[model samples]
Structure formats: C-alpha cells, structure tokens
Target: MGFFQRFFKKVEEVNNQEAAASELESELYVESPEEEAMNLWVEIAQNILVNSVRATGNSVDRAFVLVEMREQPSFDIFYQKDGDLVMWYELEDPAIKERIENELLPQAPSVASAVNGNFAEIGQPEITFAQLQFEWATKAWFSHIIREDDAHAKLAKDEVLHNWFNNLSTEIKTQQLDSDTKLSWYP
Candidate 1:
C-alpha cells in the first residue's frame, strides 16, 4: 500500500477500536466520585481546545504534554495551508514554551518520515490524567503520545490550567454530556 493508503488505514483502525470500546463502556458505566472528577477535567480540556479554535479559527493538529513540568501543555494547531512554518503555536507564556521544548518534544530521528504533509514521528505522550486526557483527545480526534512517567498523577489537578480554561459550569456540563454521548456507544 502507498503511504497515504496506510495512513488512512491506521486512522480507520483507531476509529473502529474506539467505537468498540465506547460500546463496552456504555454497557458497564457506573457513576462515582472518581468518574465525576474525571469528567470535569475532560470538560476543561475540551473547552481549552474549543475556545482556542473559536478564538483563532484554526484546527489543532496535535497536542503535546510536558512530562517533566506540571505547567500548561502545548498544542500545535494548523495556521496556513501552505507555509514554511505551519505547525508551531506561539504561546504567550514563555515558561510553557521552555517546558515543551525541554520536556515534551521528541528528539527527531535523523530521517523523519513525512506523513499527511507533516512529520508524524514523535514519542509517546505523557499523561497527567489518563481518562480525561485520553477522552479529550479521542473526542477531538487529535492524535496524542504518552511517554512513560512515574510521577504524574492519575487525574491532573493543575489549578493554573484549570483557571485558564475558565469555561462556565453550564457550558462544561453541556459539553460533558455531548462528549459522553459521542464517545459512548449504546445498544
């Protein structure tokens, strides 16, 4: 198969896996405190992406998490369809930028593979909150990478990012329900 064909096949495989898992989750879901907190974080993360896209009119290509630092994670959104530098987002926060370069970005292989007009090779994404982060990524259809980390929390409670997300409770609640419906498969 050609490169594009293989890429599409991989994407289809991922989608099918998600659909099956969602169907299983719907059958087995039981609400608890842990699940509530997890759902909250997922809402906040989604708001961050939705608000960002609304503000800039750009679709996110991928989001990278910084394993070493507990500060804000980084997202690479598409800016120009044809440009030399179309992948980078200029975050106003210098601290976040420094952390991304040092902690999250994967060291490039000598010869990078070009897939979908972008360099698709990167290390696994480190997760602070597995359920929320993964749900957000899956909902957005955004590819993520998780690097192995011993110190990260099961659910990220970064107050700074939470405050930054700052979406209204009603908005988040509605979003949460929408996300759940989309991600959960019901018979």
Candidate 2:
C-alpha cells in the first residue's frame, strides 16, 4: 500500500467506526445537554461552510476548511485550487461574526482557545491545552526548548504554543473528510 492508498483506507476505517458508534448511540439514545450543544454546533458549522461556499462559488473539495483559533472559533474557508487563496470567507461583519461566536461560545471551544485563552478567560479548555501539549511534547513531536513563562513575556500567547501548533499541523497533515474536503485547525 502506497501513501494515498493507506490514507484513504484509514479514512474509510474511521468512517466505518463512526457509523458503528452512531448506530449504537441511536439504539441507546438519550439526549444530554452536551450532546444537544454538540448537535447544534455541528449544524451551525455546517451551515456556515455551506453558505460560505455557496456565496463564493467554490467547491469544498478544492478548498480548505480551517477552524481558526486566534479568535472566536468560526469556519475560515479558503479556496486552494489556484495556488493562491482565491476564495476566503468574509467574516469581517461584526454582527455575523458575533452571532456565530456567541452561539459557538461554550459549544465549540478548540485547542487554540485553550492554549491562547481566546475562547474563554480561564477554564477546562486551558487544562485541555496543557495536557495536549504535555502529551505531544513528551512524544517528541517537536522541540519544547522554550519555556511557556518565558514565551509569555512577549505578546501572541507563547512561541512554544506556536511550535506545538505547527507540529500538530504536520502530524495531522490535511485531513480529507467524507465530503472530500480538506480540513485542519490552526492557532
């Protein structure tokens, strides 16, 4: 098996596993608060992506769906077919951004939110980021020579966190979803 072959196979396996899990969940279904929020987030996220693509006239397969962590977590769609970013989601509208951000506030806090404290001031997200960093660093995914305290003396969170983000990007590569679209998270 070559790289692409193995990659697709793994994706198919994951899809199968998810399908099995979903079936099991449906059989034993009980809608909890967490599950309810997750369902809502999934709907909003999908709507944003679909609407953005429709507005831009770009195909999802030829674009990158980025969940940016530097701000209120929202979809950052980018068209990647023409080498340059030909299509970008216009999220500069404050009303639109806020509506999405407010709805997603507690529902979809990401790794970057935890690392940079962008999503919440102080919470479990931060703890999650710390644990994630410790695991990845212990595994030697990237060098953690710089201390977090030292990096925090300057702005933009920490250099060490940035390094971790870059390392994670390398680790995850560009994940191809079942919809044949590329997706990744960034700090």
Candidate 3:
C-alpha cells in the first residue's frame, strides 16, 4: 500500500473514533423524558410506602403490608394474613395520604364498634392497617353469607387472599424487578 492510502485510512479511523466518543458523551449527559418520569415516580412511591410504614409505628402486624410501585404510577399493597401473603388492594390515586385517609380512616370506627360489641361510634378513632384488615375480612365473610355465595362460602378468607394474590402475582411478575425473589420471599 502507498503512504497516502495508509495516511488517509488512519485519518478516517481517528475521525470515526472522535465522533463516536462525542456521541457517547452527549448520551451520558442527556436523559430521555421517560427515564426522568420513571425516576420521579419511583422516588415518590418509595417515600409514600416508607412513610406509611413509619407512621404505623410498632403496631400488631405492622410490617404486614408491602408496597410495590408499577409502571402506571400505582401502588400495590401486600397484606400478610396468617402467614399467607396477598395483595389487598391497589392505590392508584396520585394523592397518597388523602386516599389513605378517606378510604382507610372511615373503616376504623365501624370496625372498632363491631369488635367492641357495641357497633356504635366511640368518638373519633384512629384506625391502623390491622384494623382495616379486620374490617375487610369480616365484611367479605358476611357478604358471602348474605349473598349465599357458595363459591367462597367455606374458605372466604383463603379465597379472598389467594384470588387477589394470584391476580396481582400474574400482573406483577411480568413487570416487577426481582419478581422471582419477591414470589419466593413473600410466599
């Protein structure tokens, strides 16, 4: 090969390497909108769940709830019932505290009254997640009895817990990071 041909080829290679390095540097500095949104969502969701758990503060079954954030910016809470793990519900609303206050707070009075054998309001009551579970389970059991829903009559608690868990598992398994570890650890 001639000196000119060799020199031209080396020049071309150097130019290509410089262009590639510059492109990589630009990519490193710039973030796509989707990535930014996802990062924000994760931060918000983690804060809510951690804060909620902290708010519970050493109650019975305090750590029973596990919250996971999905792509739709929704939170799924896993309820640990009698050693069986299941997702009790999904919180899709953007205002996490308001949603919890509205939905969970109301049940406290009713559940307390029911358990206390008066079925009457006892002034203002602060309901924890455990009380909420009691309300949910009792309501589910009675609903089945009232409707004579034999499909879930004998094992209402198990049925309710398992059905929701299975459904959530199917959806979450597909999207969740380290889902296999979650399934094994939680189950």
Candidate 4:
C-alpha cells in the first residue's frame, strides 16, 4: 500500500479499536481510573492544539517533550500540536532534559507502540495519573510521527486533527493539566 493509504488504514484501525473498546466498556460497565487518566491527557493535548490552530493557520505537524535548564531542580514536559510556525518548550530543568534524552526518548517509541496496540495495557489498576498522562503524551507524540506522511490524506484528516486538538483541550482542563503550555519556545 502507498504511504498515505497505509496511514489512513492505520488511523481507521485505531478508530475501530477505540470504538470496540468503548463498546466493551459499555457492556462491562467498567470505568478504570487509568483509562480516565489517559482520556484526561488526550483531552488536554487536544485543547492545546485547537487553540494553536485557531491562532495560526497551520496544522500540527509535530508533538514532543522537551527539557530545559535555567531553573534549579525544575523540569517540564509538554505536547506540541498544530499551529503556524511556533516552537514551544516546557520542563525547565536541565537534569530533567538530560534524563529524558538519555532515558525517556529511547523508551518512548516502544511504550507508545504498546499503548497504541493495546490501550488496556496502560489501564492497569496500579497505574498512577501522572504515569498515565506521560504515556498518553508519549503515544500522541509518536502518533504524530507515524501519521506525519498522511496529514494530507483527506480533508477528514484535517477534521480529525481538529477533533484531536479539541479533545486534548478537554483533557487538560478536566485534569487541571500543566506543563508550561507555552506558545513559543527557544532551545
């Protein structure tokens, strides 16, 4: 299959999986805290993207976490969605950035893949809210990379992007999320 075709196929698969899981949830009448947490982050990320898109005419092409230095014992992590040419930074701790670069980034792809493949893996009973948010962010970041080539698949992708951003906003607001939600950043 062509790149765009494969990308759309993957998106459809993901949507189907999510739909099936939701149906199962309704049948089982189960509400997991971890699932709630994951949903929360997704909403937050969506919101950030929506606002950015509204302010600018560009779609979100990349999303990732960053670490910074300039504060003592401080760290930040954030998601970048669609927007006009803008660079934003979160996590202001040098140590945090170093740790993420050395540790988190390497583990991110696998973790994201796993979560995307099976969202339930992350819905562990013991999973903390913080951890869930991190996982969601990681997955979202990776999703951006995998879907990068498919951004223009159809006008529907644009709608999906808008919907994703809006959902992320809801997640952020509902969860009282934070991570230096900045509009511009410098390395």
Question: Which candidate comes out best when scored by TM-score?
Answer: 2
Off by more than 4 A, model 1? 1-30, 58-85, 88-140, 143-187
Model 3 earns a TM-score of 0.29
TM-score of 2: 0.34
What would the per-residue lDDT of candidate 2 be over residues 18-117, giving only the tens digit for each residue? 4443343333334554444334434444544445444443332333343434344333333433223332423444654454445433343453443344
Superposed Cα deviation of residue 108, candidate 4 (Å):
23
Best candidate (score: lDDT): 2
- Which portions of model 3 show Cα errors greater than 4 Å? 1-28, 58-78, 81-162, 166-180, 184-187
Task: Give each model's whole-structure lDDT.
Answer: 0.33, 0.36, 0.33, 0.34
Deviation of model 3 at 187, angstroms:
16
**Candidate 2 collision pairs:** none
After TM-score superposition, the amount by which residue 124's alpha carbon in candidate 3 deviates from its true location, in angstroms, is 44
lDDT of 4 by residue, 1-187 (tens): 2334445555666587844433433333344656554554454445433333333223233342321111111112334343321223333445544554454434434433433333445543211111112222222322121121232322232343344445555554434223433222110
| Candidate number with the higher TM-score (3 or 4) | 3
For each candidate, give its TM-score against the true structure: 0.29, 0.34, 0.29, 0.25
Structure candidate 3, residue pairs in collision: none
Q: For model 1, how does the per-residue alpha-carbon lDDT over 41-86 read when each residue is reduced to its tens digit? A: 3444454444433343333322222122223333323222221212
Candidate 3 per-residue lDDT, tens place, 42-94, comes to: 33334444444433331212122222111111223454333344433332333
